[model samples]
Target: MTSIALITGASGGIGRGLARQLSAQGLRVAAVGRDVDRLADVEATLRIVADTTTPEGAALALETCVRELGAAPTQLAHCVGTTLIAPLHRTRPDVYRELIRVNLDSAVYMLQAWLAALKGAPGSAVFASSVVARIGVANHEAIAAAKGGVEALVRSAAATYAAQGVRINAVAPGMTETPMTAGLLNLPAVREGAGRQYPLGGVQTADQVADVLNWLLGDGASRLTGQIIAVDGGFTTVRPLVK
Candidate 1:
């Protein structure tokens, strides 16, 4: 039987890249997202349009995967997240709450809803974490906090599910070229400054991150779990020059 992968937020950006990559690797892809039209464009073996931001939506998405794909997914990729980049004091309560719900709660709900399936099938769950989860950045209070929770969630789930033949891991990316980073890249100075900060002197691509994720979900990374792999083009390890 062909392996199956359920990728949340699969309508765009990194999520879409992962969907395409996994599908190309002969895995059945269940593309999940709130945007039905966009999700339909993913060209996957299956498509599930459910807003992962809500509990009901998450359940429905998993149900679709089980019904159409013939089993629980052999790989789960939780890529549903949002960011509100603003200083703590300037950030509104609603923004923080929404960020937490989208970035942290969605992953929790998806995992809970699919845990039995995952255990029965024995697969990998990969969360798309951010480098900001580890490093502090200006005007990123809400997003950073939510992503930190994601890192904690990955480690906790990995430990909890290891005995069940499941592996949980996260990929922390930095300055990737995606629609999410378009605004920052639009500004010439911001783009150049961001690039210079990376030791590789360039930004990472969504495809590069997708490649790592594909490997993690495959047997090549069978022994890996509870690890946060950085795909930041050396940004996480390099220190900025202080002049």
Candidate 2:
């Protein structure tokens, strides 16, 4: 049977790549995001405009996908997130709250709505985490804390719903080149320096990360649950050799 997938943040980098890749593989894709026109060219079975950070919006996104696509989406990719490069002291209250809303809150709200939509049926969910959430990275206190919550949410939800046939996992990637990150990577010097930080020797691409997210949602990952897969080019695991 063709799998029905609900991809949130479908207009963004990794989410867009996943949507196109899954659709190309013959899966039915319901690409959803807050911007209607942005999600227009995401290459999916359908495009949905919905803000999934709120409970109401998340419910609407899932319900609309089910009602419009004619089935409960057995696969989900929650890619809705933002980045912040700042120290905890410099991070303002409003910035932290917004960070939580974008990164953590969306994960909680969307996962809740998706599981409820499944109604005891087996399903898979892959959320986006970051390498900073695992290892220490300076000036990354905000993102680290936010995505850390996402990591915890994935593991806890996986445990809670395992008996119910729900598989919850997350991918923690390192410095990736996306529109949302262009400000940090657009300069030639900064880009080279950023790439050098990875032991694997380069930054990541949207498609590269999407590939893992795709696998987690597939049958091959049948036993993989509650695990945070690091797709960070060994940034969190290995240190580069000295000259």
Candidate 3:
């Protein structure tokens, strides 16, 4: 049987890149997102229009993929997330709720549906996390909290399904050059400052991060599980010398 790969948030930078790469590898890909027009540009076997933030939508996406692909996805990449920058003091309740829904809740629901569809078959899943979840970043309380929940969920879910031969992992990228971070990077000063903050001296790109994620979802990472790989240009682990 042909392996099927499902990617959420396929309309976004990371998601679109993953879709193209997976499709290139000949896997029957299902690209899931809310925007039909944007999803049209992604090269996948099936483009599923659904809101992954909701349980119903997540289930529908999986169901549709199964109907089209004739089997449950053997690989899952959840790229849905929000890049909200706000300290708790200035963060509104609604914004926090939306952050949680998009960054955390969406993964929860999507994983629930994905696992259910897989039954007892072995599968691999990757979630998109961030540097804020590992360290303290100012003005990122809302996004950090939400992604922190995602990390927790990845570990717990990995533990829960490990014995069943299901692998779950996450990749936490630092200041990637995606549409989600365009607002911050568009400012030359902010972009330069952000690049300097990374020990490697530059921000990462969506395709760069997607490369790590694609490995985690393939046989090459068969022994890996419950791990959060940081693709942050050493930002999360190193401290460069001051000039």
Candidate 4:
């Protein structure tokens, strides 16, 4: 059977990549995002314009997707997130709130709506996390805390839905070059320094992370659930040799 996938944040980097890749794999893709213009460019079976950060918006997104596709989506790729770089003290309450809304709240709302749409049918969901959620990273307090919540949500939701054959997982990436990171990566010195922090000595691209997300949603990952797969170029695990 051909898989139907609903992808939130489908106008942006990783989400767009997933839409293209999944479409190539013959899945009927429903691309959802806030920007109609950008989402129009995404290759998918249906393009939905919705915020997806609020419960109403998430529900509308799923409803519209199903209405257009003629069936509920069995696969989901939630690529909605933000990259906030700031120390706890330096981070404003508004900034922290936005981070939570974009990263954590969006994931929660989307997953809830996705699960409801599935209605006991087996499905798979892959959302984005951050390497900072796994380890302490300076000047990343806000994003880390929000994504930590995301990591926790994935595990809890996975366990709750496992008996029904529903799978949930996340990919934690480090220093990927996307529009969200454009400000930080535009500077030569900053970009180089960011790259060096990874033992593999380069940042990930949106497509690279999208590949992993795609695999986790496929039957190849039938046994994988509630796992936070790190695609951070060994940034979280490897200790480089001291020169």
Q: Report, for all candidates in order, the number of backbone clashes.
A: 0, 0, 0, 0
Q: Report the lDDT tens digits of candidate 1 across residue range 1-243.
A: 998899998976889999989888888999998877887678699888898888899899888888987888878999888777789999989889999999999989988877866646588989988888878888888899898999999999889889888999999988888888899888999989888888777778888998898889889999999999988877778866655
Ranking by lDDT: 2, 3, 4, 1
lDDT of each candidate versus the true structure: 0.87, 0.94, 0.93, 0.92
Candidate 4, poorest ten consecutive residues by summed lDDT = 79-88
lDDT per residue for candidate 4 within 1-243, as digits (tens), equals 577999998988899899999999999999999989988889998999999889999999999988878888999999988787777999899888999999999999999999999999999999999999999999998999899999999999999999999999999998888888888889999999998888888778999999999999999999999999999989899976668
State candidate 4's TM-score. 0.98
- Pairs that collide, model 4: none
Q: After superposition, how far is residue 45 of candidate 1 from its true place, in Å?
A: 0.8
What residue runs in model 3 are displaced by over 4 Å at the alpha carbon?
none
Check candidate 1 and list the clashing pairs. none
Full-model lDDT, candidate 4: 0.92
Mark the regions of model 2 whose C-alpha exceeds 4 Å error after superposition: none
Clashing pairs for model 3 are none
> If scored against the real structure, what TM-score would every candidate get?
0.96, 0.98, 0.98, 0.98
Query: Which ranges in model 1 have alpha carbons more than 4 Å from their true place?
Result: 240-243
- Give per-residue CA lDDT, model 2, range 63-105, as digits (tens): 9998988888999999999989988999999999999999999
Model 4 misplaced stretches (Cα beyond 4 Å): none
* Residue lDDT tens for model 3, 149-209: 9999999999999999999999999989988889889999999999999988888889999
Q: How far is each candidate from the true structure, as Cα RMSD in Å? A: 1.5, 0.8, 0.8, 0.9
